[model samples]
Target: MKKTSLGIFTVASLAIACQSGNQAGYDASGLDSTALASITEEAYKSYVMKLSSDEFLGRKPFTKGDTLTVNYIQEQFKQLGLSPGNGDSYFQEVPLVEIDTKPVSPTLTFTGANGSLTVKHLDDFVVSSKRLQNDIKINQSELVFVGFGIVAPEFNWNDYANIDVKGKTVVAMVSDPGRYDKSLFKADTMTYYGRWDYKYEEAARQGAAGILLIHETGAASYGWNVVRTGWAGPQLAMVSDDKGASKTEFEGWISQETATKLLNLAGLPKDIQEQAKKTGFKPVPMPVTTTFALKNEFRESKTNNVIAKIEGSKRPDEVIIYTAHWDHLGIGEPVNGDSIYNGAIDNASGVAALFELAKAFKAAKVKPERTIVFIALTSEEEGLLGSEYYTQHPIYPLKKTVANLNIDAFSPLGATKDVSVVGFGQTEIEDYVIKSAAKFNRTVKGERNPTTGGFYRSDHFNFVKNGVPGLFMGSGSDFMEQDSTVINKRKAALGGRYHTVRDEVTEDWSFDGILADIKLFFDIGYTMSMEKSFPNFKPASEFKELGDKRLAK
Candidate 1:
């Protein structure tokens, strides 16, 4: 027998208590308060510990770790007595291609009037080929400086205007023009146009043979070392039906220093970035050409997105999804004698929260009116691939999904007086977050740095892109009973470990904050589950029209 807030109760007794409401009490939203006890720190810690342990090998997809990770999640769901979410199965197969692209030479050389300058691999530049082919080559493709390489007509911005990049290698700056100029685009806040992935997509759309984004620490929100570590190994992509023919032959990054050398070699001004930031900046065709080739070793493999659900008793067609990616960096380049990028805080924490949420929902005395779907997604580290695939081929109709609540990385710092909502004020779904936070005397706030484009970096953005309102919450900054120095040091320490082999669980971690967040998440999801109204995207939101179209369908 399990001991809940209502004292001793077997599984049978708990179900009866749910129905009779004798020992268990209900909140203002009619959610069973007793169920909240199920989201304990012990359970969360256990899941995080087990999942992030060395045996999991960082939980990367297409590895033995992937098989073990998915099996653990599925077995947990089964033990919780939840039905499979994907109609008779707990797993949704996501096909992916692992492409290991290696350059033919140790250095990529640029030939110009000034002479030839070579950039070393993994030091000055890093490149990858998304195309599903054994061999790829770019033979002295003309080099053109294409500013930001964005094409957003709505924002009255077109970097590609009056320029033809056909068969040429376009050298663009990472991030958008708005990053430098507050008057342009979204100002300090980064839109999708600012993402490197978007830059590559735009370049491919313009028929560019290759695209190299100049990496600036401030604009890219990360150092060159981070980029080198991420792109040095095999890259994963969705196994496209067209074999990625629509993409550019190669996409890469060149360090800011290397970019400067190339610009100086071409006799271009060092103030090129300043000129590009201004409106109506045109592309400059540099008198330089480079030959690049990649020998790609690729293999097609499948991974699973572990999904399970608690079906609604009344309106079963409608759903409220809770998602978190289960995959991480896997075994990567050795750092400090450690090879596994465990990703304990990056996502294992989120998956643990997912499990706790499922358990909490099951503990409730009353069943939700809307189906509650728990998806332990995969490959979020490699460009939010799992969620993107799910949105593209939804098991439930897009029109029927109420909203997406996503958890990516949870803070290990202690409890705070507020909760951070990424991409704040985009939808009415935030109202639920606000309401839930108020119960615990915590205020709602936006992320500390909106310019990093944190919202677009997560899996929830995929749901928002597909017309479903989505919400992503983060642990608040204002730690209770902790001084600013201690907090800053703690935060900085964790920041240093992010995405590295050192992302393992530390002994000083506190789950008090996480437990509080879990309750708030449960409250929001529970409220949405019982509500008949759908949350709509705000008019200023880029996804507004998509939301309207979804509901119209």
Candidate 2:
């Protein structure tokens, strides 16, 4: 792919200062209207178009696309007059290992009392191994059905409590019991235990040889195609001291059809899912066994988190962060003769938003009282590896970091009457979000579908996990110019193209929506930067105690 330079654009070159104070027809809450106006549709479109173009090769890390992408962002920060965020360097090195796993035999056969069944790879299932070893094999391992595969002491639930899963293959359901039984867990508000990654971690902790998640569309919040494509290539993970030997031997997913057949073969009831939802449900040892083997090819390399900052005039040590991931799926399985997964919305648009926000801060009439940091993270799609690395090894002190505002995959469907804050009531940052939205006559709301675990699915969750108050906003459903039916059709169409080659910018997209969102984000970050006190997690939030401890001094 040929790389092209979009040229440098400085704060002075924006010429936004000339049209200050309500000239752009937006009366924000006394913020520098000049800075707000600087975030223009032209600039946003240019950045998105350039970053998501075929020339960028989907911006995957450890590839030629990565070199071009990071260099481009560094150049932009330099032109925008922002200083390097990490001790005179715009890049923070993140060591990682990429593993490409291939099955020794493309079929997994399960033998039970009824009969034997064989499933084809990618069609009925998809699997991968995290271990650094070149070969991994599980021979005729006993299969145990562990409901949800979660062990939450606070919830008084343990799926692996009575049974010894050592050296056995455990099959679990995605999501949690609360998703089906309102009486258990958070009741549709998916907890961390509901996430697939958590399930794999718990299985490995319990000494399971292998784990296969039964994929149901609603339970996984995505289709089989997502699993088939997402797990098809090289998987990236942060470099481990033990080289991932501690993780499960292998983790994979089986389609609902395959799972049903497996259950029937074991003479288990068809209503097993309903039974699994009840409390005190025990792990069912299927009278079946299967073999799993994979050959892995891995390499070690270092990717980058592009960081830039604008120092505060007064309290330079205190900081506020704005983050957006820049990496995508790169060239992958071809769809409609196209292999490049140009993640225009998933998140070249987000990186574009990061630059626009940086431009706003730089164009402010007065320097902020707290430093503002912009991070273009890498490898968020590959299980948030970039963020995992950053939070573990922070460039700034975690305690001094006031707040994190994250942008990911902004809608291009024009303006709406409301804006959504993921995990709405968790932190006082919601107060800031509400006040900011009010300035534009927009209402604030929680995520429309909490069962999808949207809160823990992004880069900001890493910050939240470390006791930082993180804000993640979404474009609300109340479209200003369209009815719900019309908007649903458009949204559904967009969802179909998500994480695929067709996610590139199209003719139907409008900048009015994302531009409004960028404005709301600017207000929140700007206000927090000027505040004296740190934001706190709400008492009901799980991270409240962590937040309290961090701010105790």
For this target, which candidate reaches the highest lDDT against the unseen true structure? Answer: 2
Candidate 1 residue spans exceeding 4 A from truth: 1-24, 27-32
Worst 10 residues of 2 by lDDT: 1-10
Q: Report the Cα lDDT for residue 151, model 2.
A: 95
TM-score of each: 0.94, 0.94
Task: Point out the worst 10-residue segment of candidate 1 by lDDT.
Answer: 1-10
lDDT of 1 by residue, 1-553 (tens): 1114113223333343345444346744334677898898888899998999999998989999999999999998998899999999999999999999999999999999879999899999999989999999889899999888888898898888988889999999877766678898988788999999999999999999999999998888888888998898899899888999999999999999999999888888889878988888888999999999889999999998999999997999999999999999899889779999888998999999988998888887777899999999999988899999999989988899999999988988878888999998688787777666655667777888877888799999999998999999988888884577776766777667778888878865778888889888998898789889999898889899999999999
Candidate 2 C-alpha lDDT tens digits along 446-515? 8998998888999999999999989889789788975677667667767687788998888768799899
